[model samples]
Target: MAHPVRSDAEVLSVASEGVYHRLVLSARDAAPRVRPGHFATLAVGGPQSAMLLRRAFSIHRADVEAGTVELVVAERGEGTRELARARPGDRLDLIAPLGTPFPLPDGPVSALLVAADYGSAPLLALGEEIKRRGGQVGFILGAATADRLYGVEQARALTQDVLVVTEDGSAGLQGLVTDPLAQAVKAIDATVVHACGPMPMLREVSAIALGLGVRCHTAVEAAMACGVGICMTCVLPVVGEDGVSRFVRSCTDGPVFDGARVRWDDIGTVPPDLEGAAAMGGQG
Candidate 1:
């Protein structure tokens, strides 16, 4: 699919549980193919509201010929609430095909994809892409319990190896997904590891990848007022090539980043202001 300009799209279906919704946009006019890991920003509310910014959501599915795109959004905030209230006929303004994609590893290699809870949305499309390119896909899904787990069945349909770990032992393995992921890495010769979930989970996966000496990439979930790089809300610490450290905008530089390149330890520790001298000392 060619990169098409952003346009207004209509809601196609709203699934049960208020977590997944599908939108159909005319992608024939889209300039770029909505590749795996790419996202789109949807504008909500009328001009009267102060919350005029667009909410970024990963492209769950894209069909260029049908001019359609789908997004699986978990209703969490005001923007998402408005989106959930939208009906099949409702139209939404969309800025799509945004951000860089997760790099597809070359050659026939074993790959591990990990997702926790709603984080599974982005990985679903990515799994399909990897399979299309003749790469073996292994999925490690983590959820608090059986009920919260979504898309595992779908993922299993796409890939032969699917492992599930629930916090409460309601279903699948009773533990963190990272446990099975660690076991998989040790048991198999995986070439790449890709993950998108909570910060803690990503950090754990990153550490494992580092220790294993394999390539790992993570898709970050940061709070953003603006989906584009205009706002500095989603700035993340990054290490430069010359061993220097800097902050990069997650909106533009990435929502996806090389796990080894990010300074995960100091991620949320940075002070917004220098006012908390005592707190800094306490942490030290």
Candidate 2:
């Protein structure tokens, strides 16, 4: 893992994408080290605001030559709303290239990339990387509506096989992304699956991939109060190689993890079977 850096990044552009905002920052030192699934945390509310915690976002694109990093921001709260209003000349405190990145295949392999809404940000980069490595890539992008679905055109540009699904019948298919996932995986003969989405979708994707005997990697959408792993706000129960379940910090250990190892159904509540749960008096 490359050492993360604290940089004062200048806003390069802020473009509106339907209900979301795309923020491009001039981050020279941090741009080159970013890989697919790596994230960044920005100080919101400026210097004097009461909001102390930073807002974390997945690195959408990193342009080493341009010295820029892009992030997709959804204005769900005041912090993000403030970030959306940033002008091209404004500067923001940024700590980036953090967390484990998606592990790429050593050789060309058929891979399926799955994402939902803005989660499409990271997987797009992953698909590009896979193509550059001489691998075949397919995308399954889902959202609640047509406006929420992202990267459909981009995914088509990357590869010929791109699937889009929307919940409200406003887009390609009117159903959950997982509805046709198994058939799609088999159709493409995918050897590995990479996903970044809501917890429920990820859980279903993991199960389908594992059930089909294919490797699956997922980037969890955990809320990190401190992106550098200090606050323990994003720890979740994950089974280790030794078969012991432990509460691991997502900020450092992973924003990306082996899909099979994550206790997806047991998320949010600390399972009593966790390594140190007995000492902490975790209830069943």
Candidate 3:
């Protein structure tokens, strides 16, 4: 899809829920350009601007009929804090529909959607897409605690079964969310496993999916300065079909990637097998 229309989008509303803030924007053209995993960048600077950087956030929800798009943000810093303070009718500049989206299966197939923390944002739209394709969606969502879990209620409403877990046993299950992923996929007879969350969680999910002999896709969470690939800070190692691992920018190449194709173990440090990666310890 083409990039989202850059506009002085109006803030329709702002609401706060446990561990997250939901901001609704009156960007009528945004919905048409966005897909499930695509994200947005919002300029939070005001006149005589104290904060100059635009903040990137995942598109949590959208209502085309209502002419609006929503973002679920965790106010961990100044940029998001300013965004959270926005009121109705405030104008915010935005660039969106960024990055690749999760691919839909060629044929309708059962899926297991996994979410950690606020990662549930993308899966809601993905679930709708799955149902539209005559497929079923089963969810396995987890967080540090029940209050931190993003969309358990919504997931339950959309599908027949949802498994929720929290670290302290404050919610459905007591252990890590990954603890039940394999069993959940088996129970649903899922063909695909889709995940979005912290790198640690994604890594574990990828491993579990591989062990179960299922296809997996992941949406990586990276901090982007430009969100449009203008800055190269979000690059990571991705293995291509030619058997070469090259650094690809997550903002444009993907925030979403084929789980198997991503060089998971070599993500943080470039591996020697890569064609031109520097071998600091020894010269080949």
Candidate 4:
């Protein structure tokens, strides 16, 4: 892993996209270091507000030549609302290229990328990397409605096999994105699957891919008090290769991890079988 760079990035642009916002920042040192699934943390609320916790966002796109990084923001709370309101020329403290990125294949192979809502952010970048390496990529983007679905055109530009699903039937397909996942995987003869979304959606995507004997990688969305590893707020149960379950910090250990290794059902609570659960006061 590369060391993170902390710098004051100037807001290059904040363009509205339906209910989401695309934020471009001038991050010279950080942009060059970014990998597909890496994220960045920005101190929001303009220094005067009491909001001290930094807001973590996945790196939507990074341009090393342009010396810039982009983020996809959904205004779900005050912190994000502040970020969404940012205009050109404003500056914010930023730490970039944090967390583990989605691993690319050793050679060209067929792969399927899955996402929901703005979760498509990182996967879009991953698709570009895969294509650059001579691999074929497909995308499945889902959301509650048409407006919420992102990167439809972007996915189409990368690959002709882009699939969109919206729960309300306002888009490509009606129902969950997973409804067509298995078929899509088989159709494309996918060897690997990469996903980013809500926990439930990711769980289903992982299950579908693994059931079909395809390798799966998932980027999790967890609440973080600190984007760095200092806070324990984002710790979750994950089974290691040695078959022991331990609590790992999502911010540092991963925002990206093997889908099969994560204890999805045991998330948000320490399982009794965890390595230090008994000592940590868990009901063992």
TM-score for all models, in order of appearance: 0.88, 0.98, 0.95, 0.98
Q: Candidate 3 has which clashing residue pairs, if any?
A: none
Residue-level lDDT tens digits of model 4 in 1-284: 74689989999999999799999999999998999999999998876889989999999999999999999999999999989999999998999989999998888989999999999999999999999999999999999999999888999999999999999999999999899999999988999999999999989988888799999999999997898899899998999999999999899988998999998999888688899888898345
- Cα lDDT computed for each candidate against the true fold: 0.77, 0.93, 0.87, 0.92
Please give the distance, in angstroms, between residue 188's alpha carbon in candidate 1 and its true position after superposition. 3.7
- The sequence of per-residue lDDT tens digits that candidate 2 reaches over residues 1-284 is 64789999999999998788999999999999999999999998878899999999999999999999999999899899999999999999999989999998888999999999989999999999999999998999999999998878889999889989999999999999998899889988999999998899999999999999999999989999998889999998999999999999999999999999999999988688899888778444
Error of 3 at 101 (Å): 0.7
Q: Write the per-residue lDDT of candidate 1 for residues 145-260, one digit (tens) a residue.
A: 88677688889998778889999999899999788776787665777898988788898899999889888999888876786778788887777676666677777777788999
Best model number under lDDT: 2
The residue-by-residue lDDT of candidate 3 on 79-150, one tens digit each, is 888888889999999887788888886768899999999999989889988988889999999999988999
Best-first order by lDDT: 2, 4, 3, 1
Q: Please state the error at residue 268 of candidate 3 in Å.
A: 2.2
Candidate 1 — which pairs collide?
2-31, 2-32, 3-30, 3-31, 3-32, 4-30, 4-31, 4-32, 25-67, 27-67
Stretches of candidate 2 exceeding 4 Å from the true structure? 282-284
- lDDT of residue 102 for candidate 2: 96
Q: Which ranges in model 1 have alpha carbons more than 4 Å from their true place?
A: 1-4, 17-19, 22-26, 270-284
The alpha-carbon RMSD values of the candidates against the true structure, listed in the order shown, are: 4.3, 1.4, 2.2, 1.3
Please report, as a residue range, the 10-residue window in candidate 1 with the lowest summed lDDT.
269-278
